[model samples]
Target: MRKARWLIAVLILCAGVALSQKASGDDAADRAAFEAVCGSCHPVSMASDLRSESEWKETIEVMVKAGAKGTDEQFEAVRRYLRQNLTNVNVNTATAAEIAPVLAVSEATARDIVKRRTEKGNFRTIDELKQIPGVDAVKLEARKDRIVF
Candidate 1:
């Protein structure tokens, strides 16, 4: 059944292409969702790719409950989009530029954050950002990803 084998191969090839397209479609959807909503409050490049599905879900919930006005469906979309796009591994030190965009803080403030962190030496954990005058626990959590050592 040479004809049957050929048909099966063609179908398999088509299926593979469809699967790739579906993955890319999901990425496009996530990017669109993030751009439409999160773009207002957060700098597009400020936040990290993502940590995990659950992390994104919880973070979105926190933002919405705090003041963000996106619909539940929209929020979910944002969460999914962020989760897919923003998951990073390096977490020890941070740059002022990286910290500034996410916190709505000034470059001066970001420099201060660096200064304080430098003075204190390496941070043993994320909570140490609180030692910086203008930084607080919530703010630290927000920028923890960009920080290391």
Candidate 2:
């Protein structure tokens, strides 16, 4: 009975790990498509610019017209990723995933933002956010309109 219980516990742990990996894997695939399609013409770094879903859709259409190569599914993936990530983020509540693309920062920087928010409380301004190590002041300034406390 003890062995059976231990085996069940291990299996549950493994299943939980697998589920989390699958979620990250889907995001990874979306990110890959975004990079490949956008990076083909210019730096994928451009994706960091905060935009509404409509604006991103327009930009993607223009890129496609300019011969950005991607299948419909790939383009859709890019659109979905941008629409989801490159939007207004509440510093008090956003996850690293949401903050990273909107601020044009790395995942590490975004995680730092989250850590700071947890430790120091909700950020009230761009200056407060900039105090976090790894966050770029310039990028935060540029995307200030997309940030909320």
Candidate 3:
């Protein structure tokens, strides 16, 4: 009985350590990507402020337009890092302006989202976002976890 209990505790401890290490690895990768791409042009501090995912996307777009050289994967990594760290908008309750920056959609699309919500009701599922005109299904899928009911 004593040996069995000890073994169980050891397994639990190992599992916890593995999970912790995985989380740290993810953070490290995001940090590395952020530094390598975004940090190359300006202080990483420039991105420290919390912004909506849409806002981060816009920032990345502007940087690309201004000739910030990076592959699509690198730009995507930076965008994901920013979105995970910064986005806090609630799609169910936010105004068009608030939704625009968080979802990386144009103001017109944001307005359409709001209009649909108003005409129908509170969205019960992320999939319901498809009802909005001009919403990209792939983009919405990528943001599913971050979105609030």
Candidate 4:
């Protein structure tokens, strides 16, 4: 009986470990994507702020059009991670992901553009952002006037 109980406990412990490990793997995958794709423009100094889930979805849309170059699934994953990390309770110090939603572009697009802008300082006008990575004068011509604070 003693041996059987010990075995049962061991099994439970192993299962718990496995579950945590799986969760950790998912987190790492999100981090990896951000670093690999989002790192080109933004510095990976430390974890950035994250915001709302709904906003994240929108941000993803913007990122896609702006040249994020991710599959729909991957984009969604990034969005989920951002939402998970940056809930509404913490918007003020929200990381880039959180702010992504509030941006004019979708979360993902906002992620790309903002990170680039963060590294580059600030964008005061559309004319200045025209030179931004995915932004061009032609593209700017149509939306330049539309861009606002």
Q: Pick the candidate with the highest lDDT.
A: 2
Encode model 4's per-residue lDDT on 33-146: one tens digit a residue.
Answer: 766655555574433544345555576576567776766666556655555454342222345554443332356655666666657766666566555454446744543333
Worst 10 residues of 4 by lDDT: 85-94
Clashes of 3: 1
TM-scores for every predicted model = 0.46, 0.59, 0.57, 0.49
Q: Residue 147 lDDT in model 2?
A: 84
lDDT of 2 by residue, 1-149 (tens): 99999999999999999999998898899999999999987899877877655567788888889999988899888976785567677778878877787787899989988988888788887888888788889878887888877
Residue pairs in collision within model 2:
none
Q: All candidates' lDDT scores?
A: 0.64, 0.83, 0.78, 0.57
Task: In model 2, state the lDDT of residue 3.
Answer: 100
The residue-by-residue lDDT of candidate 1 on 1-149, one tens digit each, is: 99999999999999999999998997787787777777777786665554544456677677667677766677667766653346332223556755554444577877887777677666576666565667667855765674445
Indicate the worst ten consecutive residues by lDDT in candidate 1.
83-92
CA shift of 122, model 1, Å: 22
Candidate no. 3 TM-score: 0.57
Ranking by lDDT: 2, 3, 1, 4
Once superposed on the true structure, which residue ranges of model 1 sit more than 4 Å away at CA? 49-67, 88-149
